[model samples]
Target: MAILTIPVAYLIGAIPFGYLTALWARGVDIRTVGSGNIGATNVGRVLGFRFFVYVFLLDLAKGFLPTYLFPMAVARFTGHAVPQLGVFVALATIMGHNFPIYLKFKGGKGVATSLGALLALNWVASLAAFVGFVLALVVTRFVSFSSMLGGLVFLAVYFGRVDDPWNQEHLAMSVVTIGLFSLLVVRHRKNIVRIKQGTEPKVSFRKKHPSGRVAWVLIPILALVGAGAIYGLAAQANRRSELRLQPYDLTEVERVGTGHQRTERLAYADHGKLLAVTCPRYNRVVLYHVTKAEQLEVARDLELEGKPVAVWTTRDRLYVLVRPSGDERHVKPGWWRAFDLQGEPVGQPVPAGMYPDDLIVTADGRHALVLTSGRGEGDPKRPAPALEVFDLGATPPQVVGRLEFDQPGDDPARIKLSASGNYAAVTLLGSNQIAAVDLANRERPALISRSNLEQSEAPHLTESKDDSILTATTPDRDAVVIPWPKTVATRGGCIACILPQGAGLTLIDAATRRLLGEFPLRAGSLNLGVARPMGLAFSPERGLLAVATRSGSIHLIAVRDRPENIGKHEHVAASEHLGRRR
Candidate 1:
């Protein structure tokens, strides 16, 4: 389905609006008219400026339709969004306009078509390029020279602002931009020679031609209005392509377990029907059954051979990390053991680093990542904190790669994989930073970027399904949710950071890294009625956020409301509580 978009784009772009308009209006072949080219400029020179406006707009629509709409339509039909296909679609549209099959392989120079495609690809760069074209024409009055200059401007501005060259979509767009710019220069070779020889035609508005005067005044205004409309459409398309956080009010559904048991982590399996909580102090994992009515009921407890630090769940298996308990803690190595959903051991334990605290499995279930603090108890030589990667398909899961932190006290706490499963974000508690690790090479994971949170003490981290946002818990009792740095920038504003300890969650704009807003976790000053909120999990299918606190209570918050419904719901005052379990 995605592959079919290319040919469709070409067919759409191949429509010769300039030639058709000339034939219908003046009974003349636009290709044989003045300048002997079937383009808007030649049509205006031979026929009238009105015909040029009509043909240019028609040409623009052909490029815009395929470049902007094809990827969106493909994504709607297929479950996955393939934005990289837009680049190919844009190139095909321009090529079709430059060499239309119906015109015997002869067509326009593709200036208007390229502009329309560029507008869809990146509106800011497109606008800048348009401005460059207008300025160049105003100075030199040479349309051909301005068109070539505009193409160069688009390439410069587009490539300059790319934040992530490693991103798949960005890389594809870069290649296409270079290809289109080269094509533009090649097609305008005769124009360049004419300009150098002082034989190129210049646009003129003589006193005898009132239509030229009217065109000089109306074209800029029309272009401005058209650019504004295209910008709005591009913004809407981008919003639809990405995942957005809906306007939600938290409502505590139920408090399932007792307090003070030190519930360290939570994992859901069996399609969100089973919830597993790890209790290191008790050396066991408590399994809960979530009924159809959304109530939690304890099903059973699985006792482990050692203290359970964290638990991860797949479709049919449960992996539990067990650390040495009592005096042997941090001295003996920890191990991860796999079990069936029934809590029966399936394979021999795989030895991990000393003081292993967290584990995350890849989307394919072919690899697992374990984060170990590597803190040695009174030993002269302490193992450096590291992220251990394993190949799960092996007979005995073997360690394929490892990433060790430079400092021994980095004390990495939690690791979370991005939506694409090509990257992982790790929280360095002792360093107050978050490390973004590239997992493109599964066997040789590399640290790509590290962001410091200044005074924030990082502990645990979670990511949105689209990898657009990352939320991390701070020991200061705040959950900081920031846009993932790798994502393209969108609408954002500054949010004031409120330091009322344990009061709420903080929102930060990923582009600026400034505080956005704080969402309090209290129902009329009642609080979550728990202290030290730690683990956080968002269930998109259920639209519920399960927050595990050290106080041993799980607070289920409803975040189900769509963004468009925000206006229908009353906005509660800052002093008032939003919602809570009654």
Candidate 2:
């Protein structure tokens, strides 16, 4: 995923929206002129209100189009859900605007990008969050407070379920994005505190604090909050560990109940027998028994005790997490750990705090591939974040090899393995490169780059059952689905359609290592917003293609007439529309 993310972040941040606005008006890089940051706030500081609006919109576009628009295009073209992946892509895009690699990795503070993220998720709440920030700015005259308070208020609105459609997975994503965004702002709390002291730089357009009474009210609230926490913890013996998942596929799946908050990843057991999903909300791992159509909380939160980010299973064994933990033995950080299906300690979690990110396992579950580093997590001081390859069958889950490029840091947006687990699709951020690695070669993974450098977010590689073909989804444009064959030899086909950016299923030429062209995927309808295809699986026996999206929609596609029926390349041909598809 980092492979594709580097270019996405670079290109998205390189947009120079703020700098361009500042330069067009004042002929200076916004960063050099104000706080020396090429972000909207910096632009607003230097360019004033009228010009800053344009900068803000442009900066928001850097976040919006890339994070939301781009992913929609890819989903429409590839017929896959890239939204779950889009979260990371959006994060990368935000990181790009905040700290662009082209600008020596120091860009803005990510306010605009975060606002764009909110907008992509839900326009109402995002707008409310925007109003919250504006209100803070209007009252306090402190942009930092406004920014922090905006996110906090948005988090509250998010957690409060204001205007949210009741869906646990969707809500989980909300908390995930909000928590991460809050952390980003929290890292700058010192600056926010300084602003409260009336020592930080103030935006000229904002008003002064309304009254001292508000601050007085805050005092009691803080005291009460602390008191509430103490009482809550005292009363609570265990963090709400009970979780029940209701599976909702378009056809045949039933939901017994819903999941608790903080859930990250989910995958089915053999023959979809059980759902082995990762729940970051309650900080536990859970296994849902599907036979009885009831969820049995098998194992709850079992990482290094930090957060279980991603998990994938083979059969009775599950390769749980691809994140770092406190190395009690090594006293180091950044590691990967594995647990059995029963949540028992299988092998010690590998430490890799130097690289903080996500991971994905191959379909066969034989190889555990790790990807880390993005935004603030990518540290140039230590070892560059890498793709640590581990052989799951090894007694200790031995590190067989790793994947890195000539680039200074990893920019992978998403790591995708073909349905058969034969090929690896890695999308690089801000660039047109998509490294197609062959799992057969563990020592040296091959690389591929697309032409035309655009802001492509999540790169999804898909394949059919019993078929060696694959396809790549470029999140930049929705008009054309570029099909890259996983054959590793020649460039392949490009399918043309009015598919939403990164939000549809696509065709693949698995033999040629090139795209076999694309067509509109029908039937699945997302609630709304950006529709990036999330996860995909093909039934070898049934020839059915199942695609799930972050918008909480699962689609069923049959492949009996897929080749001749699809790839005809007609936007009107698709039975599904972008609005419904999301």
Question: Per-model C-alpha lDDT, please?
Answer: 0.69, 0.53
Worst window of 10 by summed lDDT in candidate 1: 573-582
lDDT of 1 by residue, 190-245 (tens): 99999999999887756553545777777888689769966764553232111223
Evaluated against the true structure, the overall lDDT of model 2 is 0.53
**TM-score, every prediction:** 0.48, 0.42
Each candidate's clash count: 2, 83
Candidate with top lDDT is 1
Candidate 1 at 125: error in angstroms? 64
The per-residue C-alpha lDDT of model 1 at residue 537 equals 57
Error of 2 at 336 (Å): 2.6
Error of 2 at 58 (Å): 30
